[model samples]
Target: MSEKTGTFVVTHAESESAVVRDVETAQVHTLASNPGLEVHDVLEATVAPEPPLEVTWEVIDVGDRRSIELVDSDLEPTQHEKDLAADAEVGDLQQEERAGTGEIHVFCVPEDEVEAAATDVLEDEETVARAARLEAVRVEVRRAPDAGVLSVRYLPD
Candidate 1:
């Protein structure tokens, strides 16, 4: 069997994104915000840190798929930002709870990549990434106003 990727949420399977996980290479399919970028022959996941945005949290329940609360990463919002987000009928988002944010979030980023990165630190001492295959890996992502831990679940291809 070829490598495969399996996307997961709550207790459901997202078959379309599920494919075999290639140990040597991979293609990550993150959300529109975080495009699945490729790393060629990445012997290991190099620490490439990005600056964190000032965010507040809000959890929008997805019901079955999963309740996804979009956390507004912008905590210190400008006057314009606040005005735009405010709704007369709905409560002020900025003033609302952080767990009440985040909406229409795509299941971004492959999980295997995260695992490989965590494991790579130990695995690299023995083996080196000689080649990489452009395989899509099923991944689960969890986000919050406070950066939470995200994990990936690989499936057989």
Candidate 2:
């Protein structure tokens, strides 16, 4: 005995495209667009059926579930932050080890999302400094987590 799969028909909008027929029942199939209406015309007025809208997306392959990037935003680093960063001291062994392993990623999210963190970090600093440098980017705003923030990675070139 053979199992039979169900036959189906589907129609979307005033689609000039569709498939409607049963393979087992050989019958005449008709593709009739509204009387005398052209493809574009069927999709235009308040009378004809709606058309399927098309949307496009750009694909990206970021290395990891990684840090946020500030690409085209109006954000900029602050002068006070510059002074503070300049005054920042070197990290001890634990800090140095984190830098060496590439584990910590920093992000500067929108001002509204920064929680119990020091307001000075985001308010004074425009760019979210990361253990790794940003290579490729999407036009978006992302924030980093609460961790020992590093002003700069003093790792030698």
Candidate 3:
């Protein structure tokens, strides 16, 4: 079979085995060997199914790999983002893809829970990886208290 190449996020990794999820397709692959992979690592690689049973996959060629960064930005959300949040109901999340690369996510939350919600996003690995799918390396979390919103911007290096 032909090899598949794309961005993959390490969902789980250990000494013996590892699991990677394709960022574009959301397909999951189980690796027979860890190959020094670590959880939350994003890899740009070519993979092929193992011979015979084809029950597992192998990282045949690695092009690039990196760990995403999640940071709490002191910068406030942009005015447009604030307007988006103003239109959204509490507990709603709105996502917009950037014109070039990356994404902007505006989340409407309760005024009292803004800090906690921001912290939750910062700690969630899947959340970060989801944003990084747009070729982002850094995720900036900003709070707009007046709008009771949290703005998460996925940015390139």
Q: What is the lDDT of every predicted structure here?
A: 0.23, 0.26, 0.87
TM-score of 2: 0.18
TM-score of each: 0.15, 0.18, 0.78
Tens-place lDDT digits, model 3, residues 30-93: 9989999987788999889998888899999999988777789888899999999988999999
The backbone clash count of each candidate, in order, is 36, 2, 0
* Model 3 CA deviation exceeding 4 Å by range: 74-80, 97-100, 123-125
> Model 3: clashing residue pairs?
none
> Which model is ahead, 1 or 2, in terms of TM-score?
2
Off by more than 4 A, model 2: 1-57, 67-118, 123-157
How many residue pairs clash in model 3? 0
What is the C-alpha lDDT profile of model 1 across 1-157, one tens digit per residue?
Answer: 1222322111111322111122433333221121122222221222121224312111111121112111222233333333434332221122221132221111122333433333432233112111111121222222221211221212112
Check candidate 2 and list the clashing pairs: 107-144, 109-143
Per-residue CA lDDT of model 2 for 1-157, tens digit only, reads 1112222121121444432222233221233332222211111111112223212111111122222232322333333333343444323212222333322223333334433233443332222222122222222222222322222222212
